[model samples]
Target chain A: MTSVLEIRNLHVSVADKPILKGVNLLVKQGEVHALMGPNGTGKSTLAYTLMGHPLYVVTGGQVIFKGVDLLELAPDERSRLGLFLAFQYPVAIPGVSVANFLRTALNARRRAANPADKGIPIPEFRKLLKAKMDMLQVSHDFAGRYLNDGFSGGEKKRAEILQMATLDPEIAVLDETDSGLDIDALRIVAEGVNKLAGPNMGALVITHYQRILNYIKPNVVHIMLGGQIVESGEADLALHLEERGYDWVREKYQEKAEA
Target chain B: MSEQVAELEKLSEYKYGFSDNVHYAYQSQRGLNAGVVRTLSGMKGEPQWMLDFRLKALDIFNKKPMPTWGGKISLDLDEITYYTRPSEKTESSWDDVPADIKNTFDKLGIPEAERKFLAGVGAQYESEMVYHSVQKHLEELGVIFLSSDDGLRQYPELFREHFGKVVPPTDNKFAACNSAVWSGGSFVYVPKGVHVEMPLQAYFRLNAEGTGQFERTLIIVDEGAQVHYVEGCTAPTYSRDSFHSGVIEIIVKKGARCRYTTIQNWSTNVYNLVTQRAVVHEGATMEWVDANLGSQLTMKYPSCYLVGEGAHGEILSMAFAGPGQHQDTGGKVVHGAPNTTSKITSKSISRAGGRTSYRGLLKVYKGATGSKSSVVCDALLIDDKSRSDTYPVIEIDENEVTIGHEASVSKVGEEQLFYLMSRGIPKDQAEGLVVAGFIEPLVKELPMEYAVELNRLVQLQMEGSVG
Candidate 1:
């Protein structure tokens, strides 16, 4: 059975100002979707709202994932249900090693799935971490570093992808993961995401550029403007938007409102 | 009420609140006087000179005024019972100890820790040491480990030579109080060139109500010797506040090294004011690792007097202040000799309307050229109602000295919390992890067992902190 995320008329407000105004979209397992928009177009807001950030208050919305309303769950509960958000600016947690944090997160998910589960054994966890690090081309020493503390921009982005690979979420939301990376770092991170996105996993790639879309091919493309997804089409639509930009879309929406 | 406040209240419950019904061999009359001091010394069978010393200390206690700075003190010194001895004499074997006293120590895991890693153990109840033991090999190595009273009687010459040399009775009001009514603390003497690989631990338990615990500890590490000493304290809860004022003095001889670690978790109804200082000789080192967790109010600053050239001192201090608690703690270092070095690092956490302050002092006297010192204080406030402060005093008369001080105050950021929680950790655990990370540097300095226990205690304090 395939998993589906149905976001219908989602309205989210931050500090009494609406950022996501009745946005609607659908993503399914085994498919990669690209969400393209300019700055302040609610692309990040939609991503944060999907992951249940406390600051993004839902004024009106229904985000149904696997037939359950995602809006009613806590962030941890959403994560236990296999939802993940690769933050654009991942915060630093000083003195917490990446391996320790991953193990804790993995144990939390495991205990939620089965209350009797103790935790991943140390040797087993080491093996699993080594395998995932190898696949992502991340150095073994990366696991020993404090999570994102004093990390460079590229290291932080790669850390996010490494986390995504280890968690293996069913529906992953990559929110501007390519923003801070250099070309080499971007290819490494993009390739990591590609390796993790499989038949059992789905991804919503949110970005403002078409450069990352070249590496991680998306089957469906959606363009967001002024707090809503106004246009969506095949993967070629991202190429079209790259050439024409959002000016034409803004003009079309203004014409519709005036009529 | 908000869920956060409710959770904080729930987490503030004291786990070591249970009391035991023990038959005290002798209990002193409530309130303090010169007669009480005389009777305490007489009961200990101390010599004439020691009695005269106590009398002088009692006079100083009466003349000195209460301190006007740091946390507010509501202690009614006149109403406190100054002495309560649970046993007639210290027991060398655990089985010889009274069942009730042994059970109390058992509950606190004193014996278990001794068997696991400690080279010696001292279990104190009220104002007397009830159980004491040292490993056979350590005893064979000419190490002197005994109760302070026994040290006075058995090693009189050595005890008299070093007793008040480091911390005289006139050091502070509390030090005077402790000198006048001191009892039950450990006396350790490591001979020349001998190194004790394992730690010697002392656990103090205050089971009675409205009583004062004055344990005066003295340690002397001879030339080229080394040892590590750890002390832990806890008390049963009571409506009226108890008092604990201890004075610990150590002398690290030339080329010797000594470490003193303290994990103080007294009941919330206790006033803990302790004065600890060490005199480091040439080429010697002294370290103080102090962690303060539970108390109504605490004002303690462990100090090191670097009186010899090339001596070194280090202090790692941590404090946790919960509801209705105030912890004013830090360290002090005096560079009195040339080329001396010192470092003081302090970490404090305040939650649920609690308050913590880091008050430290670093002083370099004239002619103490090339001395280097740095002080760092970091405080974490868990809630808006909690409070933290840093008071760092640096006085340097030497123009050639180097000094640096850094202080930071941080709250658990919402972004960090969201990041962790979004990875499947719950809110409270996420906060606990962040706090654990905040103190990781100091925790790593502790022994494995102590580091683990400190982390567990921090987690317990963080429960329901986020709602």
Candidate 2:
């Protein structure tokens, strides 16, 4: 099957300091891929580069999403192309309610899919929003609050999942959604991701812990070190890495680099 | 940045720059003197006391040199026409107003707003109020809403008692100028125990060039009464600069509450200098929601004198300065009675080489024990060339008082922009949302229509900032 997202020899830097060096990855439809790595291994850098963050310079690479080259697009264009990133730390946008933000995102995606689309009606938008919130057990009051303003860590994570659910992106890159979440929140977020996983969508869950995968049940797992993938295995790879830590992976990558 | 500069060049095109083709019944010669003041008062056929008051104010205005402390406003007094009255009489009904004058208010959606939400409406064209009306039910409830001139003619006792009490002619240069030639403003009096649920609105429009608009507004909320008054001002863009110096005085009697909201969107050629003040009586509350979005230069500070024990005052100010515009505005509160409190929140945004400043004063008197005051001023600069400044003075003569102040100046955060854009919002829209959020505290306090207009103006200011 053709992959939903293909990243080849991805190289990215920030302020002249190279962070993502020659990374390669692929995500197929309906498949959940887990990216595990230690701290400072540039996991979040890869996610940001994939989302076309301006600060993360794409020195050399090609990111193909649904036969379209993502590097040539703006961040909003990338998002309109069904690429979504569940940020580990979502920025607080005061005065913009969550419902309004979701409606805008949904409208942008609809307009992108068909230029003639006039966007969704308000009543229908509210209904869809309520349905999504109910699916994740989010409170109705969350829709009225400012976008992530004064939200707790778990609330921010839940809001991110809520956005993924509402936008219904083709491929989602969730960067460390598990960090800072309590057990109940982790389960709920993982369940949200699992419920959204189907033939029409793919997910790349970047995390440092094996705990989230226990609930997510990733189809494939990859360990990253030194800005490159060091090993690929089944979901068990996450458990092994969590138990043994990343020293072995670092050693293997060092030896490979020397060779 | 080059694209932004190109966009800034297009900013000179004003949206409301259409001149109305009409002849004025009375247009003062373009200068100021005792004769001009006499001419204005004599035209209105004022009583002897009012004419004397006008002459006294004119002398004060002549003696008081232009203020040197605020934004640099290069208004040539000789070039400005002191008065321009389009209509000979203030009409109580829209049908009696001239068609040309009515068309301007129609274009501004004033009648529609009045129908939907306002209990009364006052539409000022040039120098005089061409139309003024209050709902019959509100009138029957003893609510008095009329033109300042009509208020003096009809309710002379009430008008004379509160006209210059809050903001006297000697307060400042602009106040003296406004007192000398004031016309076309709203005078609302809500009687005791009566609450006007809907807002009383006043719309001021300047159509003629080289003219100065001086409107005096007086509002008295009687004991146990409540009211909300909203005023909006705009002028057609002109090559020769115009001047606007108005005075607004309000009195919140004991156990009353009053909210005054002003949305000023004048053309860039106008210098807007105004003084607004209110006195909060025992257990009364007064709120000032002031938004300044346009003008070549603006220097306004709405103040409240908490004269009665346990009174409360609040000021929520929002200022937006675009290219070639300077907005210097803030709030002042004087706590003169025991247990009084006041709060001031100011938010400002500047872009495309514009400047914004927050200059506020908070004074707690010696006899006022247990008084509290807090002031917060936050400014956002969209580009490096834009500027913002904060000057807050808090003087405490009493030892038993709590005072707090916080000020911050910030640029639009790159991370926040990315966070919004990652969710499919365009760069310009994202920036607009950030700005709207920055002033959300103040905008939320405005009426619904004003809030919507404020957001649209913010979006217009944020246009072309993204490359």
Candidate 3:
């Protein structure tokens, strides 16, 4: 079976800053991969470069998502290839209701991938949104509000999960979804993500703390140091890092990178 | 002035021939002067007071010259005919109206529109109204709906009292011209504590080229009375130039509410220069909904005066300028009383080398404490050849007042279009939807039919649009 996400020797930069020097990672189908790193270790930068943000430039390497060249596509084009990005700081678009925006996005993706089948009608789309809201334990009034306007940290993260469940993208790059949430809210978000994640959907969970991993146990743990992952292990590394901290990995990887 | 001039006038006749088709028994000669005012008054057989009003306005008109602020004003009053009436007698019965005049209105769906929803209907053909009527129930409530000519006849004292009160003859040059040559328009008066539930509409159809239409409308809503007046105009496409300079004056008495809507879609040859003003008394409200779609050059700014305590004003206007057009439109509000409020939102779209401008004003008087006003001007330039401008002025004399003004001019971003097209909406549909979304806040304030028609017109104007 093909891997859902494959990033080989990925080198990316931002404004002459070397964020991701050389990173290699692969998550197979039906798996959750958690990349744990300290500040300025290129964890979130990898997510943006993978999702094809306009500002991030991929200097070298290839990103193959389900046997397709993800680097050659635009942000929206990458989205059409069933790739989703849950930003740490979601942008707000005032006067655009959440319901209307999501419907437009979903219809656009559908029309790009399949031409004969058009967008969902208004009533049917409303029904789908209502059911998704109920499943996510979100209030119906949330649909009427502008997209992420004045939303709380927890609400914004949960809204991301709600969008995830709606679009059902093949690969979701969760960029620090647990960064701003409290422990309980983080658990709730992890539970929502776990429920939405399945055999067909692969998730790349990017985070700094190890608490979210307690709720969401990843199939593999990748340790990022100095803009690249220097160590790969099973979920035990998450527990080890939680007990020993990132200095151990950082010092060890610094020596190995120099060698 | 010369024999060749007379022969040349005879040779280059009207491109649009509605003047000759809709015949009248009594009419004034071409051009304007003090003698023409007396001639037009004599033709109408108006009383002495009406004749005096016209003579005073003629003096003011002769003293004032054309405005110099705007760009490329092509008004030639010397070559323009000041008065041309379509009928001698105003008909109470619709059947009594002439066949050609009725057919002209029939094409515009006036009869069906009146039957479906209208509190009153007044149709003006050329310089005189050929048809005017009000519902019986409204008449029973002492609601007066009549043409300005009949208003001058029947309500002479009331007409003289409020005539040119809101906008004086010295307000501007074209205003004085309109006051002097103004013939037929709608007159509305609602008694205290009564509300007119339906829309009172006045349709001005100009069918004659080289003929100038100067219609003056006055509306008075008594205390606690509410009314909505809708006015629409259209002129047949003509090669030769036509003139339309209307003056609308509205008075919302203490605690009364009134909304005046004007939709002007004249042909490209018509110079649409109108002056609309309204005064709101204590605890009253006034609203102006203006939509300008077609004209060679339109310089119109509806003004509102908040005179009494707690008066409110809202001006929602939109302008669309296509090829060879200049839509110079906006609004103004003056808060005179305490706790008054006002809002002005102007949206413009220009393409095909056309120009759209927002020139607005907001003023708060010295004693008007706790006053608030906001002015937002947004212009969308669809191509490089088009132009858009905004000039907003805000004056606050009181300590406790809030004023905000915002202006933005931007082209349609390619990234937005690409995003929409990626979603499967065709390029044109995507562009249309984005444009509609840009103006959604204003369109939602309009009536349903008008909103839909405006959207359709926006899309049609952008047809075959290319960078």
Which candidate's DockQ is highest? 2
* lDDT measured at residue B180 in model 1 versus the true structure, 0 to 100: 88
In candidate 2 chain A, where is summed lDDT lowest over 10 consecutive residues? A250-259
DockQ values for all predictions?
0.77, 0.78, 0.13
What tens-digit string does per-residue lDDT give for candidate 2 at B346-417? 999999998999999999999999999999999999989999999898889999999999999989999989
Clashing pairs in 3: A108-B423
| Chain A TM-score compared with the true chain A, each model in order | 0.97, 0.95, 0.95
- What are the lDDT scores of the predictions, listed in order? 0.83, 0.81, 0.75
True contacts kept of 3: 0.08
User: Top model by TM-score, which number?
Assistant: 2
Point out the worst 10-residue segment of candidate 1 chain A by lDDT: A250-259
**Which has the higher TM-score value, candidate number 2 or candidate number 3?**
2
User: What TM-score does chain B alone reach in each candidate, compared with the true chain B?
Assistant: 0.85, 0.84, 0.83
In candidate 2, which residue pairs clash? none
How does residue B300 of candidate 1 score in lDDT?
94
Q: Write the per-residue lDDT of candidate 1 for residues B154-227, one digit (tens) a residue.
A: 99999999998898999889999889889878789999999999887664222111123788899999999999
Q: Write the per-residue lDDT of candidate 3 for residues B1-467, one digit (tens) a residue.
A: 34433422442343222222223354455567887888888888988877887788889888897887665776557666676553432212333222433343344444443321111112333333332234565688888877777777888888778888998778998888888888877778899999998777564222111123688888999999999887763312222226778899999999999998877666565688899999999999999989887778898999999999999999998888888899999999999999999999998888789899998988899999999998988898878999998888788889999888888887876655544433334556556656666676777666677676666656655764311
The best-first sequence of candidates by TM-score reads 2, 1, 3
The digit string of per-residue lDDT tens for model 1 on A1-259 reads: 8889999999999999988888899999888999998888899999999998989999997999999999989999999888999999999999789998999999999988899998999999999999999999999999999999999999998999889888888999999999968899999999999999989889999999999998999989998888888899999998998899878888888742222
- lDDT: worst 10-residue window of model 2 chain B: B115-124
